[model samples]
Target: MSGPIRLWVAVKHGVDVVLARADRSTGTVAMDRAPRKTSDFDRNAVEEAVRIREKLGGTVTALTVGPPTSKEALRDALALGADEAVLITDPARPDLDGRGVARALAAYARTHPGFDLWFFGEGSTDHFTGTIGPRVAAEIGAPSLSYARRVSVEDGAVLVEREYEHELEKVRAAFPAIITVGQEINQPRVPTFMSTLKASKKEIRSFGPSELGVQPSDWAPLARRDRVFVPEVNRKRQAVSGADPATTARGLVDALRREGVLP
Candidate 1:
């Protein structure tokens, strides 16, 4: 492991989509204001990347695509252990779909050839499509390992243990590969006050689509979300009451029998 393994990690800024509460009529989250944090799954991938960089002796780069709010993700990555960070955003302020994101990342990969390994969470919390890793690999023409629980470098190759069917399987691939990690991979490290303070000074480079060799058409989403809505519960609610506990119990049993709950 004399030569460091250049690691690249893709991270997503955290927001609780469910907690925002969707309006079925509008197909949008009623998020007047929502607390945001880094997703646990993405954090796991970041942690693994740092650990691999430390063991194999390589620089770790955290990359993300979003608006100004996404800077938090880059800083968080730096605090957690990434040597550097990159933020890719749009000047016009538009949303990118999964395919668009993969394309942009692929263009980035082509522009930056130093990274020997790329890491991602099994799925993003906001969009659990689980398609980004494979899509990026396809775009970049690299080997990929999905659902990896553990990863290591050995004998000039990357070794990974991943879930296969009902059991785990061991697989190996040459360098310059992609890995999408599951939550079982490893626990992410919490940054201390010192680390947080130090991370503030780390370099955080910003890039636009042009800088990454990405075109508007290349980054345009394949599909757009038309709307969001919660499904109707379509059920009835009833209450059974009694003056005493014994009476309540009897009434409950009688009601269950009447409703054909008891066989």
Candidate 2:
């Protein structure tokens, strides 16, 4: 808050849920070969970080943990207005579970301290565990604000408006805190051609598990995902026909009531 706020936003190159195709025969999603993109909500996080920096004067560093391909997410962040990018990945052991990823992030934060704010999405697009932000905050002993719909920095403290099922909760924490934002926060900006080109040329700092003092065993998944399958849904295809509009409407209502679609 003094000189210039150092803000870090975490992004993930997760499966593009829209583009992902499920195998009809196996009734499972082909995660291994699924096309990937930056997690949708993380884009909102990056946008909010940039907006805050623009208003309060600060630098935004985007961080990601995954395989080499994860850099794609960083590039997207850079194009959106991040000043720097850091990628924590181990080519030898590319895959890590939620717990392992939290450890890697905590290790990086411990090594490179002094970040005033760390931002993240409420959850990833593919796997919405909603744990990484809180886990990292726990590891670093920082206040964690999850499901934030509105965030602002003032008087050396971060203020947040979190959404609940029944009400909106207001909270505040000093600098060096973590915030997980939901999609309701703000719409992410699309990168222009020039920005995208510049971002493509920007240098991204890379690191592995060892560099972060994370052991090989620690990188393994604590909870393994045995399989992922799309649930089979059966729909009743019925139509209501009548000669008049009122008759048709009444018939439709009657059918919906019979099917328990209306009460």
Candidate 3:
């Protein structure tokens, strides 16, 4: 709180799903050939970090563990208000699994103790696994705060609120903790043209696992995807016909009951 706090946030550069195709034969989606942009939810993460920096004196550094294109996501974060950015890339495995991504981030954490706060969206806009924050917490040996809807800094600690069923749960942890925030935490502000231009000059640092003294054997994927396929839909299109509206309504009700649509 005394000195400028270093804030690190994860940004996801994702492709537009409009071109998403499920290969029935391969049982996988064609991802490499799709258009990309900064994920919608990740913008909220950067927004929250910028908000914290605005209220409290600090600097925000955007972090992304992704392919080379992920720099677009980091630039988006910078324009929104991050002071700097870091890109962790592995050409061998461009699309890293959740645990692998967490390991890389944790390795970065080991080298960069200057980060007082690290932020992530509850889940990426594409894959909503909701596990990276906890995984990073385990890798870095820091406390994990998940599903945060409301957040604040108090006495050099992060105070968080999250939804639990019909109620809201509150929790807090000291600085240098990992927090995964839900989209409800804050509304993202649109960066002005001037701010966008200023962001272009901010430094975007790059790193690889080797630089952190991390060996390929050091990080293993916690999970892997076999394939992705769209399930076939079966629908019964039946019509209820009658001379009057009330009769048609009754007929529809009968048809629903007969089909077991209503119990």
Candidate 4:
């Protein structure tokens, strides 16, 4: 690009999946029971954006939509290399669906024009919906590439490779577009002690829907959680004991057949 590109990366804070709990009684996923952190895929997206800024000479802005507590994710992004962070939070926005999140992001993009690129993870690790990037792009009337496993920028055009069920799909699109990166893109760099210290002092901008001229009625219905429950595990096994090699071989074959490993 001729001018300095302003890159924006969208991230989300979710319950650490390792510690998340499903409240069967209330049929809701409870994040309060577990510690929270930035979504893993989003971290990769941030890393990719950072790399792009470093190579192309630009600024990286990390954006997130969530409750006030989501500032933690923003701070983490700052520690990772984002130049600035923005958090869109409001109580009325509770349970904001993919469309609502996209609308908010589109509003932000409209307010801050001239951004050469926008980046996002292929999908949040927790939800795995993988729809926000395209939805946001549609709302903003911008081009977008999703599930990009590899990416390159050259002479104002962006090239990307997306993973398909049985093949790799390639695409070339101009800048001022949105791209959602897959985990295969690159490993996220860990924050150094110095970076963390600096991030502590970095200012994070916060805003509400009203500031973006968004109305609650404009948002689509939030996704509902009818019920949440831990899955039950069942296992059956039988030991075949024998001293003769031939007998053991025959027994093993029978066991395999019984288990449907062989027909």
Best by TM-score: 2
Q: What is the TM-score of each candidate against the true structure?
A: 0.85, 0.92, 0.84, 0.87
- lDDT per residue, candidate 4, 22-137, as tens digits? 67575456654556789999999999989988998889999998788888899999999999999987687655777778888888788877777799998887778899999999
RMSD of each: 3.2, 2.0, 3.2, 3.2
Candidate 3: C-alpha RMSD to true structure equals: 3.2
Question: Comparing candidate 2 with candidate 4, which one achieves the higher TM-score?
Answer: 2
Worst 10 residues of 3 by lDDT: 219-228
In candidate 1, what are the lDDT values of residues 126-167, reduced to their tens digit? Answer: 668999899999998899999999898876678999987898
Candidate with more favorable, higher lDDT: 1 or 2: 2
For model 3 the TM-score comes to 0.84
Order of the predicted models by lDDT, top scorer first: 2, 4, 3, 1
Alpha-carbon local distance difference test for all models:
0.82, 0.92, 0.83, 0.85
Model 4 alpha-carbon miss at residue 67, Å: 0.8
Candidate 1 segments whose C-alpha is farther than 4 A from its true place: 24-27, 30-36, 234-263
Q: Put down candidate 3 lDDT per residue, 235-263, tens digits, no spaces.
A: 77767789999999999999889889898
Q: Candidate 1: minimum summed lDDT over ten consecutive residues — where?
A: 27-36
Candidate 3: list runs displaced more than 4 Å: 23-27, 220-222, 235-263
